[model samples]
Target: MLDLTAPSFMRAPHEQLVRALDRSCFAETRIILFGKVKLVLGHPEIQDMLKDGGRFAVDARNAGHASPFGMKFLPASLRVLSDNLLALDDPRHRELRHMVDGPFRRIQIEQLAPSIRETADQLVDDMIRDGENDIVAGLCRELPLQVIFDLLGFSDETRGKLHDVMKGVAGGGSAFDVVRAIFRLKPAQAALRREFENVRSHPRPGLVSELANAGGDGGQMSDDELLAMVFVLFVAGHETTSHLLSTATYTLLMQPGAAYQFRRLGREARLVAIDELLRYCSPVQMTKPRHARRDMEFHGQSLKEGERVMGLLAAGNLDSRVFRNPTQLDLARRPNRHLGWGGGPHMCLGLHLARTEVLEALSVLFDRFQELALDTAPDNLRWTKRTGLRGLKALPLRLQ
Candidate 1:
């Protein structure tokens, strides 16, 4: 059995974990740190669970879920925070997804590429001015935050406050720290509610305004629901994309000739490369725990009703049954069915936007700074301790 929460497992190199899990028993069960929750490994089995929502549900409120990092939560605040699409079942999940789906469609996200490219160029320019810097802070972190703020039509003051709240939440420290961030989220939700109202009244040209005007699927969203959706997008859109940018950059830089090879590819080819990077990097390593709505037999294992199971997305991506040479980063890999963005109904809402940001960032970084290299030894670089999300804490680099 794989013990994901073990100190050795957490500290081991990421690739080592992927390879080990891929070769382990297909039905191997692992216990997570939180209340010893069960993790579901194996590519096909995970894919089936994600797609089979009737059997496995995303909403864990009734799964007797424990507080994150074993923290004690304020029930009221926790309830509000947990009301997003990720935790919703069908009907409501389908309704809200429909409302926002138009804004995140591929064509709509493509329309924002020029601006995304401009943002990337500006960040690269600043990096060039600073001879040596942490790419995580200077480039990866700021780009996604800027793009998401622009898309959401946030004011400077509101953006700063949201950033502080999310930064605290993303810090992912001890149980006390996690609980503190959960409490802090209430005020952030209030601030976001104000922004939503502003956009609703003024009718701006961005996603916030679109969401405010959205209805007809299941009537207008309640203020609480709106807050929950925005909260989910704020964290998902900002943190995940930022981590992808940093990790993809780190991965490419570490591999000899990978960066140059990626840059030389044509636009269509570059998009394909980004997909492969998403698969190989697997930034969001695991999905939120899904509960078995009823007792079910899966792959010779029995699960009782309300039992929680987490899909190890990273492990699935590296499964040899799906991708040949799964461990290698093949930029041109095709027909890649990786679950990096997840699978089924709860797949990432901002995937197109995330892809645009990462592609533009990579292109701009290499185009401008041809001699960019790591300032610190690869072993000295730090990885974030966050359990579900894989990302660098900092990546210092030498730009010439």
Candidate 2:
């Protein structure tokens, strides 16, 4: 069994794990580390499982039956955090998703391009002034956090507080750390509840206002649900994209001539390059555990009711049958159907915004800095000590 929480796996994950899993005789194997999670590695099998909503559910709270870590003992605050759209099933998911779907659509997100470009340009300017700094800290971290703060209409004070709160939440890997984060998150949640109510009373031009006004068959979400939704958006919206920017940039820099090739690409081509980067990086390494709705046969393996299954998205992205030369980074790779953003009804809600941030941030960085290189040795660079999410601890670089 692979201990994904170990420091070694956190550093370099995708290659060896995928290789071993792909070569394994079973399509799915039990990993004792993440509560004995039944890891689904094969591309086709993962796709089928993601699409089969009738047989598989995404409620993490209800996944206690499959969790070896004893999630039933988790605090109510922690349990409420799992009540967002990512954990919802069917009608409720569809309802809440429908309410907020229009705002995050491709066309809607494209409207924010000007502001995003401006923010990216400003971040590059700051980096240029510093001459030498960690890209992860200076650019990668700030860009997404700033964008989301602007989008949500959060005040500067609130933004700083929220950043600290999220850092506490993301920094933890163990059960004890999670409990600590939950305790620290109480004030943050209360603040968000206040913001939601404020937005409800006085409409503003932001996602919070949109969500505050959202209504459907299920009626308005409770204060707890709203708080959970905001928490998800804040965490998922920034954390994954920030890591994507850092790792994608690192990957391109590491590959000889890859950065130049990416720079030379046209607008549409650059967009394609972003897609390829997403495929290659597979930043969010795995999906949240999905519970089987009933006893079922999947890929010749029998799964009991409520058994947990996690789609190894990074593995599927590197599957040889689907992507040729799976180990190589092809900037112009076409017909790329990588499950980087997951699939089915539970796909990432902020994908358009994320793509926009990556494209603009990378473009600005390479364009502004003439000769950019790593300040530290590649081996010295560290990965965050967190499971499910893969990202750099710091990306120190010199821009001349």
Best by lDDT: 2
Q: Relative to the true structure, how large is the alpha-carbon lDDT of every model?
A: 0.77, 0.78
Error of 1 at 66 (Å): 12
Q: Write the per-residue lDDT of candidate 2 for residues 259-365, one digit (tens) a residue.
A: 88987888789889888888888788788778887788988888888777888787788888888988788999999998888899899999999999998888887
* Worst lDDT 10-window in candidate 2: 61-70
TM-score of each: 0.91, 0.92
Give stretches of model 1 more than 4 Å off.
Answer: 1-15, 22-33, 61-75, 130-132, 171-178
